[model samples]
Target: MRILAADIGGTNSRFAVFRVGPGPLEREGGLTLPSAGATDFISLLERVWAGLGAGPEDFDAAVLAVAGPVRGRTCHPPNISWGIDLERDWPGPTPCLLLNDFLAQAYACRTPAVAEARVIQPGTADPRGAMAVIGAGTGLGHCALLPLERGFTAVPSEGGHASFAFVGPEEGAYEEFLRKETGRPYAYGDLVVTGSGLSLLHRFHTGRDLTPIQVAAELRPDSPTLDWFARFYARACRNYALTVLATGGLYVSGGLAAKNPTVVDNDHFRAEFINSPAHAELLRNLPVLLNANENSGLYGAALFGQRALEHATGLEA
Candidate 1:
């Protein structure tokens, strides 16, 4: 069976074809399209299909990992100009799955490979326990991985929008600063820990706004603001870890964290991660691993499509 999988973000869309046999599917070459390449999603799909030299009927299954909420059969694109209606113009009657982009990234965690994943927390991972997965990209995305008797199941979560808790006097001041700047109550995943969040923190500290790219160019370890934001970011991770009892591990994946290895790989992050009030001992021993694979979402989308097909056909892998 041939499976077509796509991971669409606000900035770029990546599509790949995979051939499924008895084992894991083999990935064909993928094509990356900029968000501005097409006026609409259908046009983008047409271009991708033509580039693959395959008609609509050539594939038996499809999966799209979208960066927005999937309501019924349509997705209101998050920050993107185009909206997606899967039922409107699909090529065939084949089964298609639409999932939150973070959920797809969580699904990708099932596959293991040697990559440059950073260990933000040095703790033990209980394979039979629950895990938390978070990514900071177009927006903050979060999901959980629950361990079952047979394998693992992925659970979508809205933890990104959870209320931001002030740790102490320092964080409280920062919260006030954020409130005054954005003119809104501070949320955990709002302008603090996201890609834009990091930039916002930088702006608050520097009295000027800078894009994520520009912030990266000016990042300095000795800068007090960057140091404080790093601690705050780690504190958020720690809070999530405590909430879920994520003894299985905490996996961090996203464009911001993946690109800025220096920020994520510092002692400050780990220190803040372990700085819990009552459960400090428990958090200190919890394992945290970063996803080094850039194509985790694409792989996970393909895996989701494959499993969805198996379930529909009543076949067990």
Candidate 2:
């Protein structure tokens, strides 16, 4: 079956066509475009189809990984100005699904996206336990895969928007700085662990302004900004791991760790992740893996589409 797969984010929109059946998903065509370049979802989709030289009628089914909560067939992404209603937008009657970006990320965990993931912790994993997923891109995303008799179920989370914990006086100062900068009355993971988060962290520490890329370009393993970022990132991961009791494993996705693996592969991150007094032993025994594939979401969407296609075929049979 032919499938249309897309990963829509605040920064970019990626679209691809894949052939999936009894074998693995085979990519046909794909394209990526900056989200801000277009005014609305349909227009952006048009660009995608135009670039790929294919239309909705060309595919058997579609799965779109949206960067926000999906209510039924519609979504209002936080980072994007426009929203999506598949029923009104899609031109064909082929089965189409809208999945939360992180949900798709969870599905991608089983794909090749993490087949060769960089090991952050060599701790033993409980094969039957739950797995946690935390990734940082335009924003921080959280999800978990709960092992089940059938297989696994993806649990979506909006935890990133919740207030972040400040450890002490130093973090308190940084929290206050973030509060003032965002004018939101609190420091949240969405702003503290993403691209803009790097910019804010750099500005707070150096008393200078620079873009996220510039700050990232200057990141050294021993750099003070890198240290603070690593600590904050690790704290977020550790909290999520404990929240889900991720003994199966913790998989890190998104651009931050992919580009700067040292962010997760470092003493600072490891120390902070295992700092929990009550759960230190459990956390130490939990494995950690980081996926450097930035396009895993696309394949994930295709995998989801294939599942839906197979389910429909089963019902018909």
Candidate 3:
């Protein structure tokens, strides 16, 4: 099947055309364009189509993994731009599928071996139970996976916007500091674990304001601020694990976590991850995995396209 897939995130929008069969998808051509450079998503799609020498009606199916909520055919405003309505604004008359970026990542998880996904925590993943996926990139993205008798079902979540909870004195103080800086209420995950969140924590600890990239560049094992960030990050992961009963294990993907393996390897990270109030044992044993694949979102978009086509036609590929 010829599938056109796009993984749209805050920073970049990547589009690819591939042919898929019993084996992996073979890439025909792809392009990565900056989100800021495009006038709008439709213009971006036009550019992609032109660059590929293909028009809208050329593809059998199309899938888009967008960085925001999708309500029916319309998406909530993307964190980076005004909302994009895929069905209405798409370039072609072919069938298209829209999915939350994280949900697309979950579908890609079904074929974990295709990519070298690393296990950060080793806990039992009940393939039959609910599984959670959280990623911190341009923004935080979340989703859940439920196993059905036929296949796996994926659900997207806005849990990243949930109110922040402090599990330690440092976090509590950080919360107060954020309130003063932003002049708005902050969620723990929103303030401490995201790309901007890391910068916020760095400023709080060092009294030096820096962008997320700068903070990452300055991060060191001995730096007290980086240590604190690791603690809070692990705590947030543990909290998410417990809340979703992610016995199917927790999969952490995205640029933030993937680039900072030091945080995941630290003792503080593991300690915080297992620090459940009553059922510490349950939380402690749940496996945590890091998706090391760089093209996870792209692979996910392709999977979403394939799945949606199957559902529509009642034919399994």
Candidate 1: tens digits of C-alpha lDDT, residues 1-317: 88888888877788888877679668977788887678988899899888888866788888888887777667876558988887785667666777887788888887642156677777888989888887777677788889888877888866767777776787687788888878876656746777777777787778778888888778888876568767867877777777778988888887777787666678788878888679888888887887867678888888888787767752221
Query: What TM-score does prediction 2 earn?
Result: 0.96
Give candidate 1's TM-score.
0.90
Judged by TM-score relative to the true structure, which candidate is superior, 2 or 3? 2
TM-score for each of the candidates: 0.90, 0.96, 0.92
Question: Model 2, stretches more than 4 Å misplaced?
Answer: 313-317
Question: What's model 3's lDDT at 123?
Answer: 74
RMSD of each: 2.7, 1.9, 2.4
Task: State the displacement of the C-alpha of residue 73, model 3, in Å, after optimal TM-score superposition.
Answer: 1.1
Instruction: Please report, in order, the local distance difference test score of every candidate based on alpha carbons.
Output: 0.77, 0.88, 0.77
Per TM-score, the best of the predicted structures is 2
The better candidate by lDDT, 1 or 2, is: 2
Superposed by TM-score, candidate 3 places the C-alpha of residue 31 at a distance from the truth, in angstroms, of 1.8
Residue 39 C-alpha lDDT in model 2: 92
